[model samples]
Target: MIEYVPVIESPCMSLCVMDEASGWCLGCGRTLDEIARWGQTDQADRDAVMAALPARMERLEGKAL
Candidate 1:
């Protein structure tokens, strides 16, 4: 059994924007699809996405806005 945990914090810094080559955000470390579909996603799905953050941030290559 899995316990559903609501995301207490969002990476969004009000700098919502997406890069052309990658679906990643320029401000927060999330993809446009992820942000858009967040409302409809289940806790498990959100967890899966959260688990991928490190890799996604790595792909960002330390770029800051």
Candidate 2:
């Protein structure tokens, strides 16, 4: 019997800088809690976090502009 493991990709860009104001990673747009729990989270949870990343990144970029 073989045990199957789900392989979910990480959003890390190798630039692990955290934005103090938003508490989000500057590169991946994931919160510290989210980043920490990512490997343990299910697909649905990971998807939810990925879905929110674009907006989070947008907001962060807007602040820089």
Candidate 3:
């Protein structure tokens, strides 16, 4: 038997607030475009975007990545 696991995990932290200046979600660290495209994007593209999220979070928080 094989165990099933999700390929991509959503970053939504449930804050659901967008900052006007940066255009990034305060909770998930994803841009509006990214969020909108997430469901349609392929696995590789999704992975690439997910890879950048941590850096986005750092930038939004004014911290060094």
Please report how far candidate 2 places residue 26 from its true position, in Å.
Answer: 0.3
Model 3 ranges off by over 4 Å: 1-8, 63-65
Query: Candidate 1 — which residues are off by over 4 angstroms?
Result: 1-8, 62-65
Tens digits of per-residue lDDT for model 2 on 1-65?
99997777999998999999999999999999999999998889999999999999999999999
Q: TM-score for candidate 2, please give it.
A: 0.88
lDDT tens digits, residue span 1-65, model 1: 99996655566778777866778876666887889888787778777888887777777765543
lDDT of 2 at 64: 96
Task: Give the top-scoring candidate (TM-score).
Answer: 2
Worst 10 residues of 1 by lDDT: 56-65
* Candidate 1, pairs of clashing residues: none
Better of 2 and 3 by TM-score: 2
Q: What is candidate 1's local distance difference test score?
A: 0.75
Return the TM-score for each candidate structure: 0.65, 0.88, 0.75
Which digits, one per residue and each the tens of the lDDT, describe model 3 over residues 10-36? 888989888778888988888899999
- Two-way TM-score contest, 1 vs 3, winner: 3
Candidates' lDDT values, in order?
Answer: 0.75, 0.94, 0.84
Strongest candidate by lDDT: 2
Clashing pairs for model 3 are none
